[model samples]
Target: MGRKTPKSKEKLDKRKEEKALLAEHTALVNKANSQTNPLSSFPAFTKFSKNGLDVTLDCKRVADMDESLIHSIFNLEKENMKNLYDECSWGWNDKKKMEEMTEEAARYLMAKNEAGELVAFSHFRFDLDYGDPVLYCYELQLKQEVRRKGLGKFMMQVLELIAFTSNLHKVILTVLKHNPAAVEFYKALKYEVDETSPQNSVFEEECHYEILSKLNKKIFKT
Candidate 1:
């Protein structure tokens, strides 16, 4: 091929730049469209019977949750997270951030015992990241006393069920590297670091947390 003239080369480069910009814009639009409004379809509450214990599961818009209740739950987990993450790195004191997560676009799943005390809770959102629809789990926390009663696994199963029913491609979450037990727990449920995870792109650099995901098997069925 002959060497391109300066004007021809300039035109080709401009076209290439335009194409790249358009592709990026298209990806953003797709991601925005993938987000779901969970409150529109999910029930207000559901009940479960596990090991003879009666548990009630309820979903609430973040803004609707009592401020005291939200503070109390976060306080309950504060110490646990401190042990797993740097004290300064934890955002527990950032009330505004918490409020943002609990807003209308988010979903809170509260698990109550037969006596009506809160036993566990999970905060999640239906998000579109990088052109894929994901059920992103922001937090899953249980009272220390209730940790061994299988509540965590039960709640996760419920979350996965919701993801599948809502047509999400996968359930995604982040686990602190210092929290090996949490990592193992997710591993038991078949969660693995995603191929798109930032860890996969870096060269020998360790991340503070691992972005793990489990595909929705139902989404693939014919």
Candidate 2:
């Protein structure tokens, strides 16, 4: 190859400068996202009456959760998962995943009722995907007793608000194909199958799950 002309060298230098600036901007954005906390000012307990029952719920980080809370969460999961998946593939007694135990401990949100009963929990994390910051919800489970009292929707609304406050681009989750109720629940909340999901393609018929996401419009309002 021949040596580059001065004009070409100047263009290369400009491209390098632009790339460096973009990298810096991305790093700054990630740092700011990390610093944002949705529960920063949240109260220790929130009181409300739902379905003729007075409820007081509190949120706790996974690291702060005690053994009793963890066990109760697992019990609730076992009870609920059975209704969604077949016994052949369900792993109720399997070891807890690292994400559930320690790796992403701070991201887990456990809500307990006034009587200190574990009522619901959500596990979520901040992620960067498709060139945007996203909040990925790995799990959201509610005890059977609280199923239709608007608690499920209430928890999800809280998660959406958290995503908005944390500057996340969207909230994303996956539902098992066997669970039509869950699919409908998410649909009712305006979550749709993501365009990028594998199931969106005609050839990917073997996919066993659907990924759903809702973009955070609060970020655009400003």
Give per-residue CA lDDT, model 2, range 1-222, as digits (tens): 999999999999999997786675466446534543455555532554678545654555566667777677767766777555553354444365433544542465666677767788777766655656677787888876777777777777777777776667788888887777788889899998886577546765466677899987875563
What are the TM-scores, per candidate, against the unseen true structure?
Answer: 0.72, 0.76
lDDT of 1 by residue, 63-99 (tens): 6778787876676556466456553365445565556
lDDT of each: 0.72, 0.68
Instruction: State the displacement of the C-alpha of residue 163, model 2, in Å, after optimal TM-score superposition.
Output: 0.7
Weakest 10 consecutive residues, lDDT, candidate 2? 97-106
TM-score of 1: 0.72
Model 1 alpha-carbon drift over 4 Å, by segment: 1-45, 87-100, 200-204
Clashes of 2: 0
What is the Cα-based lDDT of residue 118 in candidate 1? 78
